[model samples]
Target: MKVAADHRSGNSFLDFLLSFVADCSKFQSGYVALIGKPNVGKSTLLNGIIGQKLSIVTAKPQTTRHRILGICSGPNYQMILYDTPGVITKQMHKLDELMMKSVRSATINSDCLLLIADICHPPEQVLGTLDEGAVNLIKSKPTLLVLNKKDKVKQSEIQKKQEWYEKNSGMDEVIPVSAKFGLGIEEVKQWLVSKLPLGPAYYPRDIVSEHQERFFVSEIFREKIFQLYREEIPYCSQVNVVRYVEREAPAKDFIEIEILVEKESQKAILLGKEGKALKTLATAARLDIEDFVDRKCYLEIKVKVKEDWRKNEELLEHFGYSGKIASASL
Candidate 1:
């Protein structure tokens, strides 16, 4: 079965012919869920497949707290990729539980599942990463066991691991990939296109995501926090864009953001000596935001204390953990 080629490529004569053929033949579109344990390159794979960084990535695990939607559109197909938070066996806080719910919701909605795993480590049963709730959900759908980070492992090891998963893991297919280097991504995409049902495009071809601009702005700040800070500080922190004002011309766009921490000490640490650390983070975030938005803007940041915010159900629900997220407004 032929699938959509990379959408980012130029429109050559051959490409145009292929596009015409795809239009006349069949068009496939559907949602794909990226699921795996922490730091297993699920986000990386999504970004690579979408050919854009829709989800925030860091060396730290659990950097992605929300289910980020990345839309990839070719002439014939549109794949809506859900980059979800990593699955954890232990729920340390209400936030973790909410994140798990988000994962399960993504699984329910997806047409197919990509279960990513780090290839450097020994292969574990796919069932081990999923909870009881997800096992049935995954089994009912077409699931692919993706062994990511293949570049870090030997060719021999890759074969061994692939064999191990194909034999032991109860998945429809197994494919080794390096999400960071874009290896074997096309094969993965083709597999998804084969699994996706035939349908019309769910969104316009040009748009990459339905999320508002402010949502990405907030995520940029959150990603920077995870990168700049160490230990509990990043985990305890939550970044929100309280206010965003777009200006016409001479005036730059104004964005007022706030960071929530659990304690005064954590707030102080975020503030740093003479508030230097916060300033540094703001500068880094603003640069990325400017690049992402393709314009310049004035950024204002404030740090606040929200005691036990992670454990607060009402607050977590408000944060879009349990319901639809109007990211800009929230």
Candidate 2:
């Protein structure tokens, strides 16, 4: 009986030692920045890779203002994805400059890069789209040229574009994918895993992102603005969550939001005739917020004129554009 008990203890110790060795030897983790021009589906690919809508997506260009972190963790790896603002070569306003700075910050922090391109568009040099400040940094890193929107083009066109990027883009690899349709996404993931350095997991295995709930709530409202409005309305607008309260089950959560515009004319347009437009926006935003948070909530929206806020560097920094990329707009 004593020998039998000793044998059982030895077997248990061996199992524990093997488990620890497997966990230590197999882990891979690193930061990856998704870089591209406006409307190139960077956010779409991020959402596809993370398998969740962490970054907001729209048909309009320059929808993402800040650098959002989307964390995807598997059993053996954790990929921290930076869904960055579209890098614009032209710096028109203080906000645009700050956004480019955000892009640079993400690029510097990331271990590798995903330089996305639109296959539907002509085969232009991907590095040419990044600002001069970020070009050298991108070149220094291992970059994968993701030719997105492959679903929109024919198979032959896809092959031609893929070959073109491989020949001219100077990227480590060229992957043609339809981020919107979930095609070639696994290849993208596999490439990322290979590039990521071997290390311990950066986040818990079940966690998907590090952003606060309020940041995403504001993004949801901003996305509705982009979808429902036209012309300069979405571009000139900013959404901020003023107050968020979590209540008990009998009472719904409470959220108060503000939308900032540059002019009274823009405010009037946002409100629409007799406030009907704002009501439509609120209803749409509220529904999406409920879905995002997985709970019912009361939403209050107000439109204010900030008078060229985009040009105001002080205000732009206050909105979390300069350095604190993930700060929730208070």
Candidate 3:
């Protein structure tokens, strides 16, 4: 069954399951992609709307490296939200460029584009901040300019910021919200629903995301690396789920996983003295994963250095981000 709710027949178990399906106002379903420069709270907004931290959030720039999916289903419709990487220019590493391309691709056919702008300043304050390719996206699309971190700013400052966007942006609308405070999220949901075209729900009510449990596990670990190390580790990291086996020991039904990085030196830093740091990350991730999935997970994380995998086109393509990049660069 695409969505578990479809099987509901008022059977005791099914009846309870049906009520758990998410619902919004009666409206058409669609996709929304959150886009912006690094550290602008796009991922935070996704988590707020879904009421789950499906997308990792950190203060560090470029915390999100690729498109992370989060799905929300309300009684009337389902909306898929893509929390994408920050758009920035970098010629040294091809993966950086490809990351921006993923953001562009996610924007296409998106019913609502959440253009996250930090509320502390006006868009002009970020002049020359947007790369050519990234700026081109805002120039053409119907986007919702979300002034994130609204709670951190004064009301007068927010209006000033909105006025700046009105003069500068060609997007459909601009709204202020604080992703951290979970403020204005429901309104954002309603606005996005109104924008989406009327159509059948693409996914079932029970499905929360398109990725497997293993993928979420990898993300949790990656998030820890990003959160704990920030600038030191994020730029040099990549988390791969090498093995994910489901355990059905009744008392210990769980999953096992491994996290892969890019350099031996980096691995050394991640593993830490007596392998203590890795152990800490795994322990924290295991609990969060268990809570998110509602099942026990025996997460095993090993740090391995692949040596400049991000810089190699072949490796990047294999990991699914280098769709247009050539093979020779590897």
Best-fitting candidate, scored by TM-score: 2
Candidate 2 local accuracy as lDDT? 0.88
**TM-score per candidate, chains pooled:** 0.90, 0.91, 0.82
- True-structure lDDT of candidate 3: 0.73
Candidate 3 deviates by what RMSD?
Answer: 6.3
Where in model 1 is the C-alpha error above 4 Å? 1-25, 326-330
Flag clash pairs in model 1: none
Q: Give the Å error, residue 93, model 1.
A: 1.1
Q: Write down the lDDT that model 1 would get.
A: 0.88
Q: What tens digits encode model 2's per-residue C-alpha lDDT throughout 235-262? A: 9998888889999887899998889999
Q: Lowest lDDT 10-mer window, candidate 2?
A: 321-330
**Count of clashes, each model:** 0, 0, 6
* Model 3 lDDT at residue 140: 63
RMSD (Cα, Å) for all candidates, in order, is: 6.8, 5.1, 6.3
